[model samples]
Target: MNQYQRTHETMAAYERLHLAAAEERGGETLAAAWASVVRQWRVVLAAAGVGLVVALVFLAVTPPQYSARALVLIDPKNDFSVRATRAPTDSNTDSANIESQVEILRSDRIVRKVIEAENLVDHPAFRPGVLSQVLSTLKFWDRETPAKTELARMEATTRALQKQVTAKRLGLTYVVELTATMPDPVEAARVVNAYAHAYMDGQLQFREELASRTSKALQERTEELKKQAQNAERAVEELKFSGSLQGENSASARVALKNLESTAQTYRVIHDKFLERYAETLQQQYFTVPDAQIVSAGFPPLNKSYPKTLIVLATALFLSAALGSLLALLLDRRFGGARLKRDHFA
Candidate 1:
């Protein structure tokens, strides 16, 4: 045979001979590889099984959480041509303003007020009736230690409870979304609804204050303008009676009368302008009240928003399997073990 044919024959015969003894573990190298894999299988199965059991225990013991949400709208109720023209510039409806409001809704001032009003720290993880309150008092002992150490500790607890709440912009329609999560669905819904009401009440109080101030200033200025107009008329009448009026000619009475007439006209015009401005001020005072409205209210959620047991269990199982496979591979390599070796089945 030629050199090429001879080389091909030798390779083929070597492969067939290797395949024939593959199942017998006739070679020392193959036997060692099999031994290593068998030794490491025990560690791999044990680690994976332990991990899965721990995961199942944790999933079973974890508490379920529920979430509720509310929505409110903020808009202007006043009618003004100037307001319409400059609404984008003057209004808080812009993206930056919306973001600022979102931040404000999540601010400690609002959040702290909500916590205090709802008495959330002392609330139970069940229904929201009187029985729930009694139950909560019983369980409070188990949950938190009595006698807070410092103001920081109290504040920290308040903030932690507050963190379970969230506020964000729903869209560009001056609407805000409020959400609260708790172990109790009813309590979550009630707290979220209470937060919405509190925010609306705050807005109403602010608007009322602004309206009162505007009304007071307008009243004072209106009175002042009326008095000024009356004074100007009286001065004109007095000048006429005293014969001090002067006209375009050499007569002093004509000239004095003309001057008085001019003064009265100026005063009347100013008085009218003030009256118009006062009316406009009254209209502007209604802006905040009408611009903002509550579009939605929160209710008890039918499902929990977090503490997903199935997902948690699946993740744990996957992670455990992956880690076990990696560890098994490493230990097998170190111990001279292999699985499904080349030509083993053949």
Candidate 2:
């Protein structure tokens, strides 16, 4: 036989061998795949057992967290003071205002007040625990700096408290939800309640400060106007008396008196307006209107919020099964293919 015929025979033999191999493997039947999985059931169970143990260990070690929530209503319409002064023109303005209030609820000023009120600075949740401090000292081989300043410690506590608290606006509504999470349910509730009160107090303080300043300015301006009005009235009287004493009531003298009287009247009008404003500002200084009202107060949670055992175990089981199945299939393909190649070559 020539070289070309020999090459053709070789190609035909390879095709036959491929066909025989496919037939021997039953052309990838479902039964065979299931059998392959069944044969590797031990591997699957072992992986699942390992995953379950790890999950249990995590559940044992991880601390449980509790969440407390406070609801606040930011109703501009209900605020008689603000409504009397200015009304929002559109819904967009109202939405923006609500969002601004949400940010304010999460502000450092509010968070810091919550921390200080709850005395959370020394809390292990917010600061390092005794064990952790000892470990850190050992790791640093006693070369660590003395300690953070009081201001730095307070700032750190504030940041930690801020991380555990969240403020969210409830969908197009005038309500905001303040949430705080902590290991202790009572502490969580206290922190959230403190946040609401702090925000309310802060708003009142801001308004009182503004009103006090305005009252002072108005009082000073009214005094100055009163003096000017008095001076103008005296000038008019002096001019009238001088004209009468001289018996010289001329057109020019009359014009001068009329002008002075008009100036005095203008000052009186201005002084009266300032007095009214001053009274209003004084009232506002004592005003007790709240910018936000607590719709729902936070209470100690009945159940822990973290380390959901069932969910963790379920997720571990699912992932372990998937991983085991993939490994089993890969091993079967590798060893089975190698055996087939050896058989075919022999």
Candidate 3:
């Protein structure tokens, strides 16, 4: 029995005691976790019940909204009766054109037309309440006098209408969807249909105006060319008559006659060209190719578009349960630690 052998025996006994203490503490930890969960069960259920009530109240108070949608198909190739001579660069050009049409659908001019046509100025959705108007006037008093001019009312109505309507281009296609949401299903459908009609009418008017202007220009040029041709023909006839009366077929007279005839021919050729263009422009005026075709007109929706009660209730229930569980665990850690220390002292 040396000093080294005695030290080794002491270390082995200490390791055995430490291992037994760790095993006992692990069992206590599992039991404490189970006790915390059991104590919080009532809190979790109460929180869930409160959440359900709040969701129900919200569903009761909110008004139902109906959505209507109109679909328009844009064919760039057949956009106008007079197609451009230059071809598109690639397929991407078609996408760009479709996007441009989408912007046109959302433009203020088109929306204003729809609003005026539908008489939406007096509609509750398009007109703000008295309180909101007062607030807006107060907020912008320093910018200018708050007089409600026709322009101001129009601007306000346009802004409100813009909020209720939306236009989206279908992905990688020539289709555009114009959607409107309102409290009345009939009004929603009417708004969307108005948008479609207004857009098509605008396109028609634009093309007709363009063709009218072109026709006017061609008509003026044709008149001028006719006069020039008549003058040239008169000059040739006068020269021929003078040569014949003098009985002289001189080289100078022949040259002059040839020059006059050539000028007249040239003028006639130009006049014919102008006449052809004028005729084409007139035909274009009668041409009735639609810029955008209505694939589907808007219809009144059968059901409300918003306030999904079940989804709202389920989300509230899940959030409340998570919050309640977290709070209970925190309280248990705070109080349980204090009790354990007091017991240890005792």
Best by lDDT: 3
What lDDT tens digits, residue by residue, belong to model 1 across residues 65-166?
A: 889988877554342423423544555546666677677677777766776787755444422447745865787556464464344344654666667788
Tell me the whole-model lDDT of each prediction, alpha carbons only: 0.70, 0.84, 0.84
Clashes of each: 17, 0, 0
- Lowest lDDT 10-residue stretch of candidate 3: 79-88
TM-score of each: 0.67, 0.79, 0.78
Q: For model 3, how does the per-residue alpha-carbon lDDT over 121-238 read when each residue is reduced to its tens digit?
A: 7678777879987887787544654564667778888888888889999888889999999989998999999989999998888888988887898899999999999999999899
Residue 54 local lDDT, model 1: 89
RMSD of each: 10.2, 7.8, 7.5
- Clash pairs for candidate 2: none
* Candidate 1, residue 116: how far the Cα is off, in Å: 4.1
